[model samples]
Target: MSPFNNTTFTHAVFLLTGIPGKEDVYLWITIPFCLVYVISILGNSLILFVIKTDSSLHEPMFIFLSMLAVADLGLSIATIPTILGVFLFNSREIGVNGCFAQLFFIHFSQFTESSVLLFMAFDRLVAISNPLRYTSILTLPRIAIMGLVCVLRGFALILPLPLLLKRYRYCQDNVLSHSYCLHQEVMKLACADITVNNIYGLAISILTMGLDSLLIFISYVMILKTVLSIASREECLKALKTCGSHLCIVLLFYSPEISLSVTHRFMHSSSHLLQIILGYIYMLVPPLMNPIVYSVQSTHLRVRLIRLFVK
Candidate 1:
């Protein structure tokens, strides 16, 4: 009823739940997350190294892959620290400002990662559809510009989020359900009306993520038609093989995100732990799996990774 009903508290306790085991359960979570973090860093670093050192990998696809690795690394680094802190220190208290900062970085990295994937899709479309001009089209300067554009797009998309949070009076519940402050979670705590925030958040998602997904889908559809028109089965197989890893990654990334959004909206508290686990999976699993996907499915990158490690 009151406009400032929940504005009394300056800070709130953020909850960190979902440890399956007993008191020492954090050890299990920490160990696995640490391993994943290490693997992600090493894997992505190797990709970056291979792309930098190997002149043969100086093509557009590898360039985009390297950027994707960097984005994944940033995503992992942004979220893992707080998660580890919650498990290690058994403390879930994050200041409102800190929460907002974490939320910003997480969303920023997420959007950047999505942008990179969209660019990768375009890169593939060019490689398959216009092989002759692929290099000219996706040259280093152009690639750099694409990367810059992706970053700027992410920043521009999420810039209003923190500002919107600034207008909110957090009186409902200061403690976020998950380890980090998610956008919806923070918005839910606001004492002020959240109609604008929700609308803006949905709009941003539709513009960036929804639009990106639609474009990727269209690109792949065009790619499929082109592949089908090819006369040779082997050539078609090879083309599909080239896109296999990317396809896998895209499915993995988007499916859970869509489900999480839906579940969080309707199911809400029914699957809080499930939501937290999915959040961790969405953030960490892609990074962990990306290297494997590239190494197993990509011959050039795999060889480069092997050689770099050997050296």
Candidate 2:
């Protein structure tokens, strides 16, 4: 045996999985999975490119939309490699450090997306509630600052997680539940004390995801109130239409996440396949759907995309 044969407290290898017990069918399963990843990447990339090249798209609303696209792209990129690795090549082995890093980025991108949604909510609210001050309130520098703050908020909350896990002992059965690393999923495998980890994870989850969702709801409530206060029905429809794509994107992103959280918490008797599929839905759906929703709903984006293709 070599000198590094023993499993120490510091480092170990983890076997990342793809639908437990269906490993043999993973390649066959990779087909749809690959398609989703490709569409997400291409769609989001196109959104970013459209925003970049069009001068009319440089305003706050479009800027925030581009931010969402970037976050979605990050999310897809972070999770796809390992997912494809598991499904296409049957490569499931990942180092402890690699797992921890993936965990950070996965949560970071998630938190960033949540933050972007929150910002987008505020953008819609400001544009509707105080149209005159909207430009004054959300200038380019301010939007950039808000984006950076969102990234930092995610990094700060999630950074300590991997460090906390590093202190624990993962001495046995080092198989991760999904193709990627998740905080709660990986935490359950730890043989060491995990009370603190559980507490912190719960607190951050509620603070980040819970708080963001609550704020988004409040923003929409206010938005509806503002929209309803309009005198003409036609004008009201026209105004609300601006938010249609954003609303769909929000629902697409959050609904599956809520289901996954519930499955992890209360669905103890749920099938492994169900849980895994829910996890996949949470990871794969939003990025793939957001751009399609925008492309369909926003005439400006649709026309611009058509122009790009024609050119």
Candidate 3:
């Protein structure tokens, strides 16, 4: 019996792929993937716990960091099940509803993370450009609202994707290129024209991540201006030092992301394995590396971590 509902014009199930042509060493591949997942969860959870418990760490910068940690955790959780299932159990079948749910959470967390990074940039700018008013300008309530807005904006943008995708009929085998379902990957299998889906997907990417990237650039530029104008070299160095960790995180998150997006859209002739690898890096690297970067770069965070461990 056909798994797809012909009358409803929707697929009931989709097949997920593990590492292409590397099925024989699925166990070996699982080792690294599992390590990455475990490290991401523990590291991000520690960041959240430390931030929640430490009174001194409740400032705007750490608040934004906590939000980023939550987003990383969400992204990791959204993908880990399917990834582990594919590698550990060889379970590749995902129901249509499950696929859509995963799709929404993955993209929603991505969009929210991007938004958090943008706001963190603004936080840096305010700290360097107007240190005296930083606390006054970014009160706890205001930051909480900003966090809420990030989530709501992501939800509003990504909520329609599954609904839009449901209107099409997938006539071909519903085998996805990656271990998990993605909006673009799912839409590519549809028999009908996906112009609306393509346009909407592209539009949201441009407006959200694209625009956020530009604004982050602008914020740093202004921060640079502010730093350079400081009279004392010591003060200037201090200001730049404050932004160093955030700069590293920005590069970590967006560099591979932009690469993967470009490869997906323009490098159609590229190696399939390369594309899948990029997808894994894009989803996994930020979560895995974020806390490490912060721990090494932020003096306060580093000290707090040391104190937590030493005692």
Candidate 4:
């Protein structure tokens, strides 16, 4: 018997899962997962490097972009180790503390990403509606404060989850759905009354991502109103153009997340395999696509990238 099977409630060791019933294809699956991780890590790193080096990119928009990149990097790094471990070495045992830590970082990064996206929406709103006051309003100190708040908010909100989860007696099944620890998935395995865990987890999700999404939607609506009210067609187009990259990122970041959230909440009869795949998509897609979308959409970033590579 595996040593982890001797798990006790207080010192439980959870077995992380990869694709269910596809153990033989682990090697083949690692290729795409590894590729995505490489791209996300390298891509976000390059974005940070370029933004740091280029003085012209030191505006509020780019500063927020850097925050998003940092969040993506954190999110990617948090999950990739266990994922690769499961796929490459068939290692899936995760201790309770380690699992809790992973769960903390994963959700922390996610919450931070959501906050940063909302901030970016606000940034766009300000840039579009009040162009002259953009720099004045989003000064360096204020931007720094916003970044700090993003970190703090995520830290405060997610720190409680692990503690709450630790209190639960996980004496039943210790097998997790994904190759990494997730709070929702972990909570499901608890044999004790998880009323508080369930409620707290739901509250955190609603307060963080849910609130951010609603605010972002409102910001865009106001942005649209401002754009339509502009007198000159050229000016209106120019204002809307500035928001395109951010809009694409907001969509990319939120779509999979919202879909997965809905699946987990409403679709009780959903396929376990499909839910697992959606979980992967929620974690993988944003980090992988954020940098790509920005690179393709932002002419300035594209030019700098080209110059860095070609020149």
Candidate 5:
């Protein structure tokens, strides 16, 4: 018997209906997307280059920043090309296998990004809470181990995606609603029982992304308490400045993800457009904002970037 016979599969459809009189909207969307992609690439590349070339940036903080940049770049690349393809070619159709592949990379990079942020939070916490032991604690070997853990965590979180897809039965409609494949959206297409998939997905989210966010929040809370306890006002202000940018970036990244998850679970159809917009925002905005946040808030990175570009 065919998979479709054994399982229930929903057809993929474009998430948005074409605008009534706006054939030009395609151009509008594509141009802005391309611009954002280019900037994201350049900005993240500049950070990577600076970290590699500047000996001073060999510390744990910059190492985490570099990895975060790499993750952001991966996240942007995974989603943007497919989105651009949809806008430019009107080809939003994705097969079951293709949908699974997209879902894998998107989730992989997303989880990796979250892992990197968690490491960053820990790095900040160490620097603030135990400055004397920070260096030894966050040693190069430790950083390497953390990096490996992030990679492993990403694969672990995404490994079940294909297996889940394999169990689903697809109907004649294979068009995906969004520009790219989203896990929940694709799961919604399944004709077979999706209780297992949904449960596993939620379990992963709670254990990994959700738990990581909570830990990061706790780290910052302790960090703030430590900073306030410092006797030197100047030192306290300097330390606060160091964390402000990261705090903003973390909030920006997690807030949308939490919102999207809540909306997808409870208010999917009505919030489809909002979901699409937030999806793009989460993927693109973080990378675009990273450069600005680091450069403006961290004098060292800002100086290095300026000097490197000038030379």
Candidate 6:
């Protein structure tokens, strides 16, 4: 009756491993994971709280930020349970449907974050390119619709994954490299042919993450061009200044991901621990760092935070 019973495909389970080569150090590993969870939750919660309570912070820029905060929180929530289970409780077994749900949520959040970053880039471009028209253009209704689109895009793109995975049976040891379930990771363990799953997975990555990253890069290029055209050097700095946090966030989100992808492709021969470390960086670092980046860059947020804590 165990989920890991080999006789039943429906009951198949994937064993979630926290870190491949560091099992003995799970107790110590839990410390960093705990820190990441608290920071991601509290930092993002503060962002939501500050933006929500202040009328002045209700612009498109901050509104998009709130959206990003929600996505970050969701990403953290998706991975935290299994991570804690592995590190604290030694719970590794995840049933078929549980794995599917985890995989879906993880990918969905990643895609949502990518889409939000792309939109945030557009937000910066519009704010800098034409400040006068920014407010009128990105109205509450428009922002709401955009947020909805982000949610739907994440769901629609990843909805097929569980179904695709279900059609195949997994007979391998069903051990995953990390504490979280990823679509590609689970698909690789399938005993059946996964050509369709592989193609679809790659296609979705290209269409979502790849396309979004490309457009974000283009948006920034245009933004930098406009910033450079300002007559006053101060004005140019001011223009670029608004994008400082966003620029850092874009790099924070994409660069590690790109590095990890390249490593997986060209450097598979490298250390497994290195890959796990990269994966940790890819998942946990952004949520950990985003709030710090924003608060450091924005005087308004920092002042507001100070006032909040002063009381």
Instruction: Estimate the Cα RMSD of every predicted model relative to the unseen true structure.
Output: 2.7, 2.1, 1.5, 1.7, 3.2, 1.8
On residues 37-72, what C-alpha lDDT tens digit does candidate 4 reach at each position? Answer: 999999999999999999999988889999999999
TM-score for each of the candidates: 0.93, 0.95, 0.96, 0.96, 0.91, 0.96
* lDDT winner: 3
Cα deviation in Å at residue 295, candidate 2?
1.4
32 in model 6: Cα distance from truth in Å? 1.4
lDDT of 4: 0.90
> Clashes per prediction?
2, 0, 0, 0, 14, 0
**lDDT tens digits, residues 1-79, model 2?**
3211367744577888888878778778989999999999999999999999999989988888898899899899999
lDDT of 3 by residue, 193-255 (tens): 999999999999999999999999999999999899999999999989999988998998898
What digit string (tens of lDDT, one per residue) describes model 6 on residues 1-311? 33444656676778887777677898998998898999999999999999999999988988888899999998899988688898999999888899899889888888999999999999999999989999898999999999999999999989999989888777776788878888878888888788898889889988999999999989999998998888999999888889999989999999888787677656869887777788889889888888889989989888988899999
Deviating ranges (above 4 Å) for candidate 5: 1-23
Off by over 4 Å in 3: 5-11
**lDDT for predicted candidate 1 compared with the true structure:** 0.82
Candidate 3 deviation (Cα RMSD): 1.5
User: lDDT ranking from best to worst?
Assistant: 3, 4, 2, 6, 1, 5
Residue range 87-200, candidate 5, lDDT tens digits: 788665555666678789889988998999999999999998898999989999999999999999899879897788777566534445567777877777666688988999
lDDT (Cα, 0-100) at 304 in candidate 2 = 98
Which regions of candidate 1 are displaced past 4 Å?
1-24
Judged by lDDT relative to the true structure, which candidate is superior, 3 or 6? 3
